[model samples]
Target chain A: MMILGPAHASPENIATMRELMGLDHSIPVQFIHYMGQLLKGDLGYSYHAGSPVSQELLRRFPATFELTTFAFVLMVLCSLPLGVVSGYYRNKTPDNVISVFTVMGLSMPTFWFGLLLIYIFFYKLGLAPPPMGRLSPDVAFPPRVTGLLLVDTLLNGDLKAFLSAFHQLILPGVTLAFFNLAIIVRTLKADLIETLEEDYIRTARAMGIGVKKVLLRHAFRNALLPTVTMIGAIYGSLLGGAVLTEVVFSWPGVGMYAVQSIRYLDYAGLQGFIIFYVIIFALITLLVDISYRWIDPRVQLD
Target chain B: MKEVLLEIRNLQTHFKTDEGEARAVNGVDLKVPKGETLGLVGESGCGKSVTALSIMRLVPEPPGRIIGGEIIFDGQDILKLREAEMRRMRGNTLSMIFQEPMTAMNPVYRIGSQMAEVIQLHQKVSKKEAMDRALDMLHKVGIPDPKQRLREYPHQISGGMRQRVLIAMALSSHPKMVIADEPTTALDVTIQAQILDLMNQLKEEMGTSNLLITHDLGVIFEMAQWVAVMYAGKIVEYAAVSDLFSQPLHPYTTGLMNSIPQIDQPVPKDKMLRSIPGMVPSLFDLLEGCTFQDRCNHVFDRCRREEPGLADLGSGHMVRCWLHG
Candidate 1:
């Protein structure tokens, strides 16, 4: 508010700001005004967006949500099985091969990888249509149901739009997933290997529990506790990584909206996105905590 | 006549380390009758625990090879059995209570869940039925409020409680034999006595045979019917506990008795405690003569030149020393 206000230092503007903040009155008065405004659903207008704060947020939120979810699904599909196999085979060829790929994914920057992917798939192979808006202009977009393009397309029973949307999503989502896949795989592998070496795992073996059961039941759940924290951290981390992905793919999502807000100095849009993500990251962290307790009975917070 | 549940004949478990083969359990021969308690007494690294692992087939393969000998357990040569068949026999026919109860049980799981899993693996029972059996075993092991206690995790309970829980789980399947590897060593004196008393009472009530492995002579004297004194991975003396203690034929066995603090004999405070000098020989070094020869005070030319086979003079007394002839 201070940065964008042209007459922020002017005596009149300063007085007006102070009155709006209720600073001219008592401290309790200002707190009440803040609470009242928050409760009513008035987020205040955007000098940059030029639309109601909520409407602009509502408009940009779907795009970001759609992109992140796609990337998350991609991460899970690749990392989980790879991690299991790597830990199971451990020092063998399978582990070696997976380790190589994981190292490659981890070492390469996500933005660099995104650009590389765009160059290969879009520019060279010409497999995907040149990365641009959510849907190509020639294809008529379906009626918005949930505001999520994929869901909206599916809801309208427009398979063509859904297929097209998915194809466009693949490169960006896979690129975003690369680094995350490396992280989850590394976490799962390290934890699983460590858990396997534990005396309980030896006890499990002594009790004649099968290797599969020992790995899946005895080791896997315990292994996932650390991975849950990793996932929660990634939930926030993905926001940053997604910016590069969104820019490269041109898929309209939170990251893309955020960059556009910063460039245009859309304070209301940027604030809305930031606040929305704080809530998101908090909720993800909460979910991780709950799941950790669910997975292992021994972890109890005093 | 009691039925012999296990007759381990000349069992030798060797680990092939980078240096050489380390025989953890070398040519150990013993027998335990059903419902009887046979105490295996040894110093650390003397193969008492290794023998227990061999009985359950829990020894790590590759580096650890049984080498030669037959672990005839429950009328089957466990060494000859396939991995799957051996696994089937482990919890149902033969179960083990490890020394460190804390590490023995999975900390992440509640005691009940782990116990129920062992029960369900062996029996085709419902989860509810398995849980009931777990609670029943917990009750038998003298745990208060078996149902509520079953829900408590290992860490939530004390070390003593964890041992009781492990004992309860081991006894749940009505295993023909239980191998306890220094089960009370980790507990304090009070808890140790409690666990020992509980084990004896439970064993008598269930009529389950036990292989009690420990270095504590006091515990061996208290609970063991037959005693086997192991030295350097070999049983130096094997006889009824009364006979073995009365006439300890092996020098190592006699030395061990002298080392244990006795209430009857009062020694001067400043006087050093009796100890058998010299460290246990490394497993990588093959014993050309007797493994205990270097440490034995009665070491003679024969003791240095040749190893002694377990020789029986009369009755059931057996000793592996040249002087025993």
Candidate 2:
């Protein structure tokens, strides 16, 4: 009521606002009512946005999703080959360099890395688009086909706008990717080194199979089992909107929305966002479990 | 020399440690005669497995390396062969059945695929054909429901079954020589006997020479025509299995025999089963003379002065001891 009600409202006005918003009920009754509203896909009203909390969250989700997807692809692409090379040539020069970089990536704060990327790529090099909203001020909003600006612009046959959105995405996406690369790389290297020493790997080698086949077909799959668990954790943080990365880049993501809600003490918005985060974390865990079953049949996910 | 399948001469496999270079297989010489089982018997940590791994070219490098050796397989010095050539020779010309059955096959992959991979590595065959060959090998190894077993992962099967699958994989390409390094050491007693029986049957059927490395003298007597007793990285005795069992020439060989608790002649409860005194000498700091000099009951001045060369007694018996020399 303090946040949603009029500024400096009297006690009578505050009580009326509370009753109107159904906050007058007992705690248990309020919980049941909230659950009912949640089941019906109503995340209450966000007076701050002059709309439902769910609608506000839905509008912002795709922006975060697009950034997360791009960053995820980058992290996987960069880390896999790096990890494989480092692990295969363990204690060699390549492994040593990669190990140093991965250690740095892990220890550095996500926001700190984000600032460094911006300083180098944005301020000094001027290669990046201005890090603010999703697009520049003059670019007309594309049709909300997928709610992702890049796809929407391309769908609208606006190649110019698509390029702008894509250009705007790269800086933030890379920042997020660099921050999370350490986990996947570290896990992959450790697992690959250990997996290479397994008796089965020796068996594979003894079978006249080439080294590449032995590493990839035999050893790599076994290595993936442990790496999958770590990937889930990294992925969950990415999917959870990487608040630090989001804040540093000013990327219009769900993380920023939650930050704004917290700043304003938007009760319904904060509650809905927290619940959504819980769901996302749980869903990512489920995905990891499912993938484990697929990768290694011995894993009894069922 | 009945047309040796594999021969090791002056094989020196050393492992670099913080202390010094540990000579795991030092100046060893042996041969696996074609179509015959040559049992390599030794106590634990006596370089038996290391010798087998050296022959297979599967020793992990950096910490362990073949410093100097000639592993002549099919008359070619494999130590000089390119990695690609060595790889081609492995599992096709020579297969190795490792000591631990539970860990020999990848836990994640199906038995069928693992076996098919080996089959396909040597033979230019379709995936389906390779899988069929794998199923055929599984059947040949006497696995019940070979089709179902192939689809199951290594962890799904019992240890004996895993060993059977390993054996099937090793024999799928009809390798010229199979180095079975303690093939049944990890199995239960009954399972051990069964594996040995399967190995025996497979050996005769395939007509492949065997380098069966084991500590069990009974297994040697049952399966091997000839036996080489290794003690601290060197073979102390090489003889026909019957001759060695009848008259163990080296003191280490005699000690090994005396330690076996005979089922027919159980000792009285008051008397303990005999055991060899003293530990195997550290490979890093071996004695200047015989490796077993410190432990040998018949250690003499000459034994202390110099290590005895393997002296060839008549009837194909060789002993590395001063008494025999």
Candidate 3:
């Protein structure tokens, strides 16, 4: 699993590193050489993985993608309404409690939270098994359909497969959710508070409309613009998927894969992950920029 | 003389502060006859705005509260009504035009939408009807190109146009009484005069009674038939405009009249306006006796120790100074 660091580099790696990093050559020449290599679908072989880096990434990608997607859904489900109420009752007891919890969530290390969850939920409560691997070893997996375990299992019509996959995912999903949820709730609460103070909300109240209508129609709609932007900026953090959480739970996601790759000086896999995140982040940021124009008419792109 | 439309009987409003309850509107009584303009004139912090707000029951509670008051309008006590009932009455039977035109309109909404919303809220009108009324109001206010301006934002319009739009919106529902709180304060001199002219014209056409609140005595002379001079949270003098101006009884009122710079008269060597001597008393640390004693140059032994009631002098004139006695 683990190999040596770049201290003892192969002749090929040395040449590539020199060319790419400009440790020994001009930037343009190195960029051209890098582009040529990249264009040929040659991501190079992983020293730790002992296979093509792309193939290794492809194998691990589904697991990380599934984890983050579930986490994102969980985050949204908890944050939006909670944030609204908390903001509506700002500085009140409920808001104060939520603030304290979010602060604790942000301060605690991901590893500690992940382990604590595993200890209580799995070890003590026995509601769930100690999370390890993507699916049960005994149950044979069908061919990947959408690269999502739950979806693929459902597509295969194997109820047993779906349940097994769902069970294993619950802990890791919650662990990942803690940090994202805290960030979203805090961001949304602040945004909603600012929106509540805007004159439109006061105008709505002055109209003698019900408070529910005032909040939903005026306050929340105005608050969502900033929330959308915050979500986009944080999309990159998902790919890196709570590294300590992955290690503690032993969920076979890209986070663990990336960590193992790094241990071995697996430059190919490391570069693959870095480049992958860069492209994904760039694409999401583009989506965020486009979204602002759609939601707020005043937002003009020069 | 017209019939009385609104009557305030012994109104008192207090504000809860760190020290104690600071009475902002102390036992003041006045009346507005139907279809007549009543000017509430005073210096800043004289609680003129508070009195206007109290009439509408829009005074902010906790810090601001109507401790004792009876705002009787349209044969009903508005202060005693439930919030929902008050909401129905407000903007339908009564409406107010706020001071700052710039902040009055919501920034996020188009003018048409906000205006239409107000119409629909009070009247069970269809959306189309609301839109038509909004457009009509816009046109009535003399906004250039009503259709184009309706879709535009508040910031897009000029200050004068914004004030007109506000006036239009306030009058759209044909409320019985309209309170214009320093409507022309935040405009240029030319814009101020234009707005004043427009308001006068609109008031005449609508035949709706207006309680115009302003510190500008010039505007009071032009628009108001009856004037009430407020000093330190109390109505120090009340009379017909001609009577009050010709023989002002309260020292505060006289001080205020002397402060007004006259362009028609020859400029004196000093050419300086005679301002009221001292600053207004802090509402928090209210004195035992007269609130105006510190500022009144004609203060006597009893003037500093005993607060005078608003005593009727003669005819319709009322004064609250020892000099009147």
Candidate 4:
């Protein structure tokens, strides 16, 4: 029904368009027909973009990858020390202060936080470039090397373009990282507190290991086991384009492509997006499973 | 008199629970002699473990703390040492073996790295040297194929093997004192004896003073040269092991000894197996006099009015009861 727009075209016109697109067949026939097309690596046609869905996905993949990678790196760098310190000195000053920010990070929606950053850094202070996409329209595109603008510009020895691209990434990257950081730290801190209570930790301390070794080597590694599962799940979503953060920053990533596909009733495009998400999610689950073996030997025993 | 190794004078450790401050170790005093095993026997929650932990200075703070008194170990006041000094002394001068061997080791680490880490911490040894020392310790503990055992995770080994690994870790530094808190409690009965035997053999070989805390009278009788019976966070009786058993004084001590199920001495058909009546008193609302007054069959007016101090009964036998005094 939504396939036809508000102009309310005649039934005859709808039938002709349907036949032209081969949608006139029964459901099973259409599925089998679509599978045959899929065998050739075709992800169907996107009426919304007027291009093949796979081509659109490939083009947007680099933008999403760069954004998620930056955000993930930021999350890891900030959360590990923050979580360990918060837990080691648990219920004390540093923990209390860190907890307050983490709670706020968890509470605020990604879209709202992204907008807030934009309001402060972009509108009020004029510190951020406009949230209008990857780069300013006036800047010439650097020669494609890695497909990530940050790397491609640096590869071309274009510092000016590198700075501009990095500026565009900052708000969204932070916005994406904040929520992920909140999850990881909360997980790590809680688990660390519990792990510290384990008999092994007390034994470790009694055996005269230094403060740093006891905390980091014994307690931290045990604590990180539970948090690894949380990180894997967060990673899969972040890799799938962090939908709300992408839309808020107007980063022309796969998430925007997905949103447009839905609004325009582009079923083929949506199907392709779902397929990509599942494949990435499966790979991430495998990585998490492998990590369990490395970090926790009892994984098999339990 | 053997030279004193570890002496505790009026050690008071308290825990802040929601109910109130739990006076876990209340005015406890005891001494361990060089190259001798002092068995600490008590009912569960009688501060035997707390006493052991206090000596290690590993009591969890905020909730648990050594609020008063001094612990002098090897001529140094343990409580007076700086944090760094205490750390150096740990696993070097003072080491501990915990109750639950199953959970006492880091499950994620190889037995080798975990043992090597403790050895390396107190000594300025390279990693390979530390590991060699670890391998030697494992061999000393009589673990079969010590080299291969070191590479295995804690769970891959049996509960008995884990306990042996713990013993190896505890003694790797040749500390001045080793506190074994029910080290074999979690293992099978057969394994328990083996572990205890291993500990005794090692203690004899190393001449490391041992503070063995256990609820089992038999274990105390077998392993300890001297025994201290604890009741409600204080030593109710202290004596040479043979003297304590032959003439068990403290009503609490007699009660514990009687409570042990006997195989050779059968109960009369009409008689029930003896057990101490009443529960250990709540540390939260401790009575004014003796903490055990409510549970003591020999309770009297003085016992209700004021607690008795441990009075020496000659030749190192002491009993904290009015009858003995």
Candidate 5:
């Protein structure tokens, strides 16, 4: 619709677009042709990029994947311990402080938060690298081993390049992760509080199990079920948030590519990006469902 | 007389609630002799469960607390012991079987792992050795196909089976005293009987003293040798189970016995089943005089003005009432 809607108005591309839209063939035939092309890994050409949409996607996707992966790791590492502490010391001073921070995190706009972080770390403190691209302007691109800049740099055995890449990643990675971390912590804390009240927790305590074992083995394991589901839900939206984050950081990722494609009326590039996002989201949902059974034996997958 | 395994002197446990301070266990004194079941019987909210939890030092803090008391078990004042020391005492010298077996054991873990964890927590044993002990305990609890049952989660088992597993876990360590808080309340009548029988048999086998908390007089009659009748957070009556049944001195005990339907003796068609009038007094607003005076039939001037203490009547039978005094 997007392609046809624009193509119908353009005088020059109209003839070629109509031919590509299968004006000579029946609708079912056109549908089948489209499916065949999709199945054969052909997403058509992006006129904006002056290349195939699939090739453009392949080039940009690794950056977004790497950024999202780093952000996700940061979210889990930061949120789990914070959530556990907050929930364990519920209604206390620490919990109150964390609650305020999380509320601010949840309410604050992602773009605004990204700008604020950049202002603090880059401008005020001058601790962070500039919000440019995935690597410094001066450094040449490392050998593409896994396509992740960090991995590729480390694999190339260039510690200096790896360190510089890591520095460039921190701001954007934290910007993408902060909101997700807040969400995870809040949900995890709520789940942990409920889990702590379960009769089995009392049973664990009654069995002379120490505080740490009771929290980690019994309470936290059970609490993680809901948090895992939350992660899957949050991860899909994180991609959406990544667009603004990428724009703010000026990071070369699929989100920025999609934004430029939309601005330039690159219909094929936009369609390809949507499809890829859906596929990744679906895969993550499947992984979360499988993890539920692992975390809670009572949850039967079948 | 048997040696005292657990001694409570003026034990008081209160809860700070929005309404007021709920005197859950108010200055209650009791004793459980070694290898004997001491039944603490009362209606709901009579502090039977609180007393049991107090003995285990498992009362939920902030809201519930032991204000003033000495719970001397195995020659140590548990209240005086540090948190770490108290933890060691739990599942080692003292273990507890909760009321609801269905939700008592963790649903996520297998029965064997939960049982084995308890063993490993208290004893210096390898995982394999602990697992072997768990299997042995499961067999002792009369669970069919013990090997398979050990690997199954709590939800996979029946209510009766879960209670049996709880019994096995509680007794696995052979603790000096086991606090069974209404252990058979959530089971069917037949299952209740089976569990009660198993507990009694296990108690005899292990020679472990039990502080059985229940509302059922029938359960007390079957399981307990020493009976403590509680009324609104105080032990209003203490006596041998047989003596208490034969000669209930406290008005509350009399009301309890009278309320129990006699199956063999047919009731008159016109007469309704006798129920104790009024309700258990709220612990939050306890009266200055007797806690049970509002419900007692034998209320007099002294009963309304001054509270009566537990008066000895003979043969170790005691009753807290103006009539007894």
Candidate 6:
């Protein structure tokens, strides 16, 4: 209300804003009216986009989803192997080296990391495409099949557009993945160390099962339970925390949309964005809870 | 005479802790002949389990190491074999059953899969064939409803049942020797008797040698053909079970024998059960002479100053004390 008060100060708009706020009515009556409109999927208009808030959110949703999914994939690919190596050769030189590198990754600020990656990969080496937007001005974007440019391009069989979008995504996705990768590596290494001490591990070794087989089949699955929980939490935070990365990369995602709404005092867009974020987070949590049963039989899902 | 199946010559296992090096098994020697059970009996921390682990090469390294030893199994020094070679021998040529059956088997795996895994690891057979062999072994161990029991996890079964499954797994590959390290210690008396009976029956049927390690004198009597009494990491007495029972030469062995209350001959109300006098000495300290000198009833100046070596006393009995020397 404090943020919106100044924006609604003009005489003609003040009456309109007062009607929208239900100023003459009691709080309970206004809350029911708001909920009724919300249940009907009416999020009102976005003053900034000059369109309905839900439609604007739909336009930006795929970008954030694509970035987060790509980052999550990168995190798992990097962390799982590093974590297993650190755990399998615990207290050795390789473990020591990985520990130091993960600590550095954890401590380095995300925005700074993003800028550094842009400097090296973009400005210095020119190995990456410029992250001005999701695609270059020359290349024609494919029709919005899935709304995600990368997927839509691939679906349309436009290899050039897909390649351009993929190159644009690499920097932001890697920057978002860095911290989560560090967290997974550290957590998994600790869990693996404890699991390796289990009697079953000794039994596996005593049976003359190869070390690789013991680690992958016997130890990895048991060690993964705690790490899976960590992944869910890290993913949740990434959805909310991608604001800086989105801003730095100039990517048109829900986080950037939220920032623009806040700056322009676009109340409807902000409210809709918060709701969408919470729903995605809740769905991820539900997926993780269901997965726990499959990963470990001892986990009873009530 | 029976052919020797396994021999430990001057086996020494030590653990390096933050405090100092703990000489868990210092200069121990014993042998198990083919088709015979040799009992290595001692109290906890007397390196009975370490000796078994040493034979299997399963000791946790870094903290525990087999410093000096020749574990000759079936005429080959196993300690000299590569880790890959040793692994091939384990669960195939030589296998072990541990003490805590509850925690020994992997909890996550089903009994059938775990048993089948061992068979497939040692034998070149189809998974179906291995499962069939596993079911056969489970039936031989007297588990009820072998097929139904195979599908259950370790936690789903009782402790005694888990131990039976372990024994079944150990014998599935038909290993020539099985090292049972206090296999019945964690079980109740009835279960212990049942497991022992099953082991004895299996040994007779398969003609397999066993190194039975236990602290229970009664178990030694029931299962072991020969007994080796270990005191402070040294084998102080070695003989046939009957001979060792009738004439315990070392004071430690005598203390152990006297400690068992005779059921046929009731003790007087005023008398107490006999126990050894002193605690087992700390392995971290260097003893000048005998490790058991403080606990021996007949400790003398010679015992305090000079360590005694094992002396053959005609027949097959041997003793490691100054009196015998």
**Number of the top candidate by lDDT?**
4
**What DockQ does each prediction reach against the true complex?**
0.46, 0.80, 0.33, 0.87, 0.73, 0.57
Computed on C-alpha atoms, the DockQ of candidate 1 is: 0.46
Query: What is the lDDT, from 0 to 100, of the residue A211 in candidate 2?
Result: 81
lDDT (Cα) of model 6: 0.88
Q: If you assessed candidate 3 against the hidden native complex, which CAPRI class would it receive?
A: acceptable
Model 2 agreement with the true structure over B2-64: per-residue lDDT tens digits: 888888888999999999999999988887889999999999999999998888787888899
lDDT of every model, 2 decimals: 0.82, 0.88, 0.81, 0.90, 0.87, 0.88
- The 10 consecutive residues of candidate 6 chain A with the worst lDDT sum are A1-10
**Per-residue error at B301 for model 5, in Å?**
1.7
Candidate 2 residue spans exceeding 4 A from truth: A1-40, B266-270
Better of 4 and 5 by TM-score: 4
**Local error of candidate 4 at residue B174 (angstroms):** 0.9
User: TM-score of every model?
Assistant: 0.86, 0.95, 0.86, 0.95, 0.94, 0.94
lDDT of 1 by residue, B122-206 (tens): 9999999999999888988888888898888888888899889888877778888989989999999999999999989988988
Give the residue spans of candidate 5 off by over 4 A: A1-42, A239-241
- The segments of candidate 3 whose C-alpha lies over 4 angstroms from its true place after superposition are A1-45, A51-62, A126-130, A133-142, A150-169, A190-203, B18-20
Itemize residue pairs with steric clashes in candidate 1: A63-A253, A64-A253, A64-A254
Across A120-228, the per-residue lDDT of candidate 4 in tens digits comes to 9999999999998889777888988888999999999999999889988988999999987988998999999899889998889888887788889999989998898
**What does candidate 1's lDDT look like per residue over A1-302, in tens digits?**
45336655788777876675455988787667655765776655565656766677677677777777778888877888888888888889999999999999999988899888878888899887677867866778899778888899999999988888887777777887887888899889998989887878877776667779888888888788888798777866565326777887776777777787788776556766677677678877877887777777776755
User: How do the candidates rank by DockQ, highest first?
Assistant: 4, 2, 5, 6, 1, 3
lDDT of 3 by residue, A8-93 (tens): 68887777756544547576876676667778866666767778877887788888888888877887788888788788778899
Fnat of every candidate, listed in order: 0.51, 0.88, 0.14, 0.93, 0.72, 0.44
- Model 4 chain A — which ten-residue stretch has the worst lDDT? A1-10
Candidates by TM-score, descending order: 4, 2, 6, 5, 1, 3
- For candidate 6, what is the DockQ-based docking class? medium
For candidate 5, what is the lDDT?
0.87
Error of 6 at A59 (Å): 3.5
Clashing pairs in 3: none
Query: A120, model 4: CA deviation in Å?
Result: 2.0
Worst 10 residues of 1 chain B by lDDT: B264-273
- Deviation of model 2 at A80, angstroms: 1.5
Q: Which stretches of candidate 4 lie over 4 Å from their true place?
A: A1-13, A35-41, A154-157, A300-302
